[model samples]
Target chain A: MSNQILIPKLAIVGVGLIGGSLALALKAAGVVGEVVGIGRGLANLEKALELGVVDRITQDPAEGVADADLVLLATPVLTLTEMASRVLPHMKPGAVLTDGGSVKGSVARAIEPLVPEGVHFVPGHPIAGTEKSGAEAAFATLYHRRRCILTPTAQTDPEALRLVRRVWETAGCEVVEMDVEKHDRILGAISHLPHMVAYSLVNAVSSYDRYEENILEYSAGGFRDFTRIASSDPTMWRDIALTNRDALLEMIERFELSLAELKEDIRGEKKDRLYDFFLRSKQSRDAIL
Target chain B: MSNQILIPKLAIVGVGLIGGSLALALKAAGVVGEVVGIGRGLANLEKALELGVVDRITQDPAEGVADADLVLLATPVLTLTEMASRVLPHMKPGAVLTDGGSVKGSVARAIEPLVPEGVHFVPGHPIAGTEKSGAEAAFATLYHRRRCILTPTAQTDPEALRLVRRVWETAGCEVVEMDVEKHDRILGAISHLPHMVAYSLVNAVSSYDRYEENILEYSAGGFRDFTRIASSDPTMWRDIALTNRDALLEMIERFELSLAELKEDIRGEKKDRLYDFFLRSKQSRDAIL
Candidate 1:
């Protein structure tokens, strides 16, 4: 194809939403020669194949990465430690390796030692996803008008970083790079902390004594709108929460302090204080909304 | 028109989102004779009339409720206390009075003494709204298939309670009744507490140093969805937090406890505990998602 950017053979570890969408987007752009999926589930990989998300499926990472010019780790944060050890050695010499996990600091630290000299390892996060998971949830347009943040370490090869950036850019993502540690703290505050609070808030209502009778019956769209992230993938969030523990904890503490101030304001019936707090929140949210 | 349920002369104070939507719904259903809007802003009333949300506009409660068959106090919760005292003297004898505020116990208590012996007074909360407010935000379908909760006290007039229920029912709401105290507690857990958490969470992110640089740049739909309620009316929420102070405080404590447990799970790297917590949250949210 004219004006096409090609990966001779692309290897995607974990052919679910992130991986499958990447594969679909690349294929739709005529930018990849072959896309191979390395995942545990045969049914899922087969479904990925049926949906044109992957050209082939393999149970072995070595086999999948043998001829891969690009090997993208599209798995959970905690799983990347093991995935790095398994996939890095098998990657072709001069191949570019990257990841698509939310917390980059841990992934960059965990996978750095495993990368061979010629292989370029860049940790990245695509800020796009639905509550839905699995290969069936893949969509070529998932990354369109979205951001893909690349967190490349000092060891990253310049050419490899450029190629990785092109891949996401070609997939219709606006790519920006940042320090790995900064990425974790950023994602932890905006993404992970909000997720934790949404889940906990829903759980608080769920476990309340009169929830089923009192709370659930009176729940309107506002509650639903506020807690929709509670429906996110459980295991995925657990891994994210753990992998980004320190940052998440710091964010949680800060959030708790804010909540405490609000509680005290309510306790004191401080209308002015309460109004200021609410107005600040509204202004902040309004900017983005 | 034979089986139509009509409000012969309905007076709606504070023609904002709730009042405007109620008038729109009633008008669409051919169930209201003449709706008079009483709001502080003449432009808002004019807009409500333009949108066909109200048939008439008036500045004075005495003028609006003079010959009304029903007077819906659609003002902010804190204002409802003074509004009840002001409007009750103007209502026709035996006219039914109700409200569309989120908090029930306080409004019911504040207005109970002011309500004349011949008049029926019922307190209510229509568990429906959008982030947008004002007369312009009203829609004819805002209450469709939604629940309208009536929190009638022991002193509430039975005929007024029935009539208030029918008003919401005629607007296409599924009506349910609960004790005033119970309604506050239930709504505090599900609705009020969730809103508080959302606003606090957003404020936390907004107050963070270089948040626009570090956080907002990478925000995904998940964060946006979870924080949408943070954009709700500032004064309305401040009033909600104060009027329902005790119940909201109790609910906030319960929510804080839940968040603490989660934080502990993350800090301890208790994978199983974290997984279970997320799973329960997912299950709870799944039932409603």
Candidate 2:
């Protein structure tokens, strides 16, 4: 409790994996006094409550955030604006409001205008996750040793940004601040584009399942590693693909160009070029690993 | 040693990860009386001898294969034909020869003609590996619970095929036989295409490294998993690509078409189509997981 960020009441809209994990981490750290889980699904809310992810569960957003000191919207990027509008007016004045959406620019732009005069809106993205989803998959250490990106604009209040940063830091995140546009572009290259490629690769291999043998059945360590991200939530990825369409499209184009080069080298039997392509990629990936 | 397939002497050429692991496994199982390690690199061969993966080390293919009961050519696919030609004449009349190349169709076609009149040749691929290479990365348990595909033709001796299957089975592999052409096509869809996608992904993300921030520095679990196979041996992958060019090219084309559909759905903001695209891929990947 010595280094905890004090929040008398915390309200989390869309208390699934991200929200449930935040609630559990804060409670385990003895920071927040009480957490209210809000979502459209009653079954998920009940499960969150039973798992000690939240102190209370509510279907109504207004009732959930009525007296809350801090509010977090941890839903799909497309749904954030609607959810924020529902909870912002009911939140206590001088309270800090934040989000855990993957795409920051559009979500921040859409939700920034709807924020009340007194309540502060700070946009954030935690670069940590598995290919799993739902409240049952939530864990207290999901944020440990991970990076949490916060995109704040000129309109963002200093105290509110500090509080949001403290919360993420308390949950075991190394917090970093960056421009929303840069965040979107970088994430598009690293995260969104990979998801698209993984999904496409899986579909491509499964297309051959109509033959006598299921190609997927012969998948070894390499194919399984590639398919791990392909098994992520469909709705979540669909929303991501739409919200960050422009940046994601640019990244997909770049990736296709890179892939095309290798394809041509393979087709032409250019062993030297193929070796260089693979060697360069290995060097790049090893630098990061 | 009762259940072991005993060989008076086993000669392994190109004793890197695959070759070294086979030697170590057979030695540990007490199936072979002696193992001679032959390779282009003296350092690696000495390491293999030091690690007890082989009882003898030699740079001469003829000296290594002289009087051997079995010979395993475990080099890259492209080099298999030349290596086979080098050792085939020196191998004993009743000796069985096999290979551990990823691509089978072209390699089998190219090497089968060079086989000596009295010796047997069986093309094989073990569906197992780490992103590591060299004799130092070899281990006895590398083939445990893994699938090893053997492609034997009309000209192959049944006794030779049985001996090769027993060797892999003793190394804890589930042996399956298939046509060389079918093996290449299926491995093209499963392994080769995935490696291409992963290497391209790593290259695309690293393209941003020319900028201020290294995008790869922020790679999380998903990106790391996707890059695991990208870090595999460049020479080995290059050989596989050139040797299996036609099937790999076809698979890449199919993957591009599949990716294009997802790109269009995202570009047009077709939410339902995007959802269905992801949903289908998720279901396919999840089925195998």
Candidate 3:
């Protein structure tokens, strides 16, 4: 172990809320030697710089990674594979590359082939975000007290993996390392399936004939909670659902089965059964809290 | 209009969160000459009095309503109808009696035959509560800025309805008057259906093989919100789902259709369709906020 902190010059691709927040955290912790932000739009890149998230901005991937020791791919899942390939040639020979994509299996497979020799590639998912998006929503403490799961393949370098773990730990995150397939499966149950259910719930109420307006008007009670989940970025969620299709579909089937059982109890006027289910479910929630 | 401020001696049955909170609000606003709490157990009644939520406590509903000018039936939905009959004979002539049951249609129908001719019956549902229950959870400002819907049948006296509205208004609730059927339907959509979904979602996740333990660990992202909703009183929610069966079943059917559409989009790998659905749902949530 080095006595001096390993301050890597980092390039953050797609400086949105997650990317920009990572840049800010890295700078705040003095773990990065220089932070450069790259994005498709110049205005977003300039805004990132103005917010002091990054030291510099570049439009060219090659130029952005010219002196970088670590590359953080923080784009949407749909763009991660393409962007990973585009930035591969520019990355330093021994530099470590990682991503912030929610779905890992597809992203890991897509980026694995594109990485050059001697460079380590790790896929990671930071399980934290608010309903808000964009660089304006970026904050240095966004990942604090949250879990960031790193899915490193068998080919990943031990030293490079240790450096990535140190980066997330400096941001005050609990780092959990897992295989890529397990990461996707667990996330589908906790994150991806919930998003799909919330979106469907909103669509269900909105499509009703006369109750649509009233539902929205009186949503403060319980419906509003689902709405907050449903209000996440559409493209991001769409990409997640499509990318993790099998696991999400399986969870949806489980949900439907439970829903059908509840509907039957309601129809049969089985108050005792409904009460038992509610009690068990409430106990589960308490256990979680 | 009475210039005397119409400070009625009030009786609140089943003085838990809703009933106890109402008693506090009535006393704070000086709208009640005396407030007496009636409960099945002596402990809750004594606790309500000790907490200053009620001026006195009574184990007998008949004894509690003997001299009261206004009586509030604040028991569970299943018990409210039977309890209404038991207390009506003891209620003073020219007194106004109302309830805080969530399902208005069943309660109104059940209580209609038991009401005496001289007394006025106005069924009301105060759409205010915390996850916490019992007298200890009661707060003076719980109903402030919250909506309280009154569902009065055609037989309900206009003067009695006016008095009930005035009481809730003094308690700082925006009062909305609607028919019993419409109130039940609307509440089924916003409150009942959401609770069912939350309970089912939790149950579905619990069915997974020990993965539920991990799901709870990482629930803060989105699933925790649903769990909180699921943690509501089991007896109360069970009665709600069973009583409001038609509307809940209808909502569930609509939800299943929407879920099927989402599943199809995921299965077909149609990102555009999924994105559009998420976008529309997000807009609805923003509109609600």
Candidate 4:
């Protein structure tokens, strides 16, 4: 734990899963003095207040971050620019503004210029989530043993970055840093593309003419995992796809070409080749484990 | 629980994960008096005996099932026919024989006629396993809270089917009965096709010229699950693919069509169509959960 509480007045915009969880973790560690939960929905804001995820609630970002030292934009990627624009004018001179967007490049580009001269704007993404969402689904352990990547530009203030890193480190996250563009491409290959594939696989199964209903009953190990991924929040994933369109499209092409090769091998009954390829995949998977 | 210990002498032909787990579960339940594990490797056999997965070990199938009331053929799908032929002649009168292979239709056809007049040959598959293999990787709880599918043809003896069902039930499995062809078709859509897609996805990433090493590092949520499936037993999957080639090939073709549709949607910037499709997938996946 740090020597003292770093965030005396922490303002959490869009107090959903990520926001609520960060507040809970910091509060549990006694590192956050006051958490002000801000959201468009009054019901969810009330829930966050009742659950002690925040000490206060606000309907507007402008009012929420008025006196806060750190303001975190934890809403959808599409809304970050507007949220940041509203909060920046009300924020104190030396306040830090960060985000927890899944895709950072677009968010960073949209909000970086809006951040006041003295205020620090660091775009971050915590690589942790369940299929569940909203404040009720959040917990202090959501970010425990997970990674939180902060994409800082050349103009980023050192103290701002350090403060954000300390916040994540105290939450039990391994902080990673990368250029925004590289983060997009890397996440395109791993996170975004895989989500697309999973959704497509489920769609593909549903389009089957003859054996639709029987498929789920026979689903044991492999198909079950696919469904679990495919069941993730669709709107959130759609926004991610659209925001990171180019890198996603490129990764999709790469994936399809690889898929074609395996299809060819299977159709041609190249047993030895198929075995070798499958073995290589197994080895790659083992490497990760 | 079955009031009486059903099997006095149980012989398992291949002492691998599924077979070893079944032996351990039955022995722990006090349902089997003697367990004879038959395998080609002396080292594995010794480990199985030491682990008490079996009471004794034998290299010869004839010697293994000589005095057994129940015999389980838990070998590869491709080896079922030969293994059955080897053990059938030596099986005791009124003994029951079953298998724990993934693909049932081919194995059922291959070994059905080899069953003696009074013997039962039930083709079964327990839908539970980790990527880890061999006797040491097995546990008594492997089959707990899992489904065991048994396919019995018209020629199958009633008592043999009952005894096999009882064995799986005693091991804390929910025993399900399906026709042999139906099992293959359903498994083709759900199990075999998913494995192929996962392997293809992994191979696709590896083929990327610019992003091979960076790809694995960025792997999160969905990618991790895909790699886990891709890491499964290669030879076993290869055998399932070959033995159930017709169904696997058909399902693969079905999956390719679905993938092609999604690819077109993404290329054309069909956001609404993609969203609706993704939503449908989420709904389908939720249905399974």
What shift in Å separates residue B138 of candidate 2 from its native position after superposition? 0.9
Question: Which candidate number has the best TM-score?
Answer: 2
On lDDT, the candidate that comes out on top is: 2
Chain B TM per candidate, please? 0.96, 0.97, 0.95, 0.96
- Write down the TM-score of every candidate: 0.97, 0.98, 0.96, 0.95
- The residue-by-residue lDDT of candidate 2 on B76-179, one tens digit each, is 88899999999999998999899999999888888889887888998899998889888899999999888999999888899999999999988888999998
Tens digits of per-residue lDDT for model 3, A1-289:
1223465689999899899888888777776788999989998889888988888999998889877898999988989998988888878788988889999999998889888887888888888888777777789999998899999897778888898888888877899998888788788877788788888888888766674354568655567765688888998898899888998999899999999999999999987898999999899888877
Q: Per-residue alpha-carbon lDDT of model 4 for B144-193, expressed as tens digits? A: 88899999898887888898998999998999998988889877877777
Better of 1 and 2 by lDDT: 2
Q: Which regions of candidate 2 are displaced past 4 Å?
A: A1-5, B1-5
Interface RMSD, all candidates in order, equals: 0.9, 0.7, 1.3, 1.6
lDDT of 4 by residue, A176-282 (tens): 99889988988887778778888888777666657445467656665777558788777787778878888888988888777777777777777887788789889
DockQ of every candidate: 0.85, 0.85, 0.76, 0.63
lDDT over C-alpha atoms for residue B195 of model 1: 87
List residue ranges in candidate 1 displaced over 4 A. A1-3, A211-214, B1-5, B210-214
- What's the chain B TM-score of candidate 1? 0.96
Question: Best to worst by TM-score, what's the order?
Answer: 2, 1, 3, 4
TM-score of chain A of 1: 0.96
lDDT of 2 by residue, A34-98 (tens): 89999999999888989889999999999999999999999888899999999998888898899
Residue B96: error of model 2 in Å? 0.5
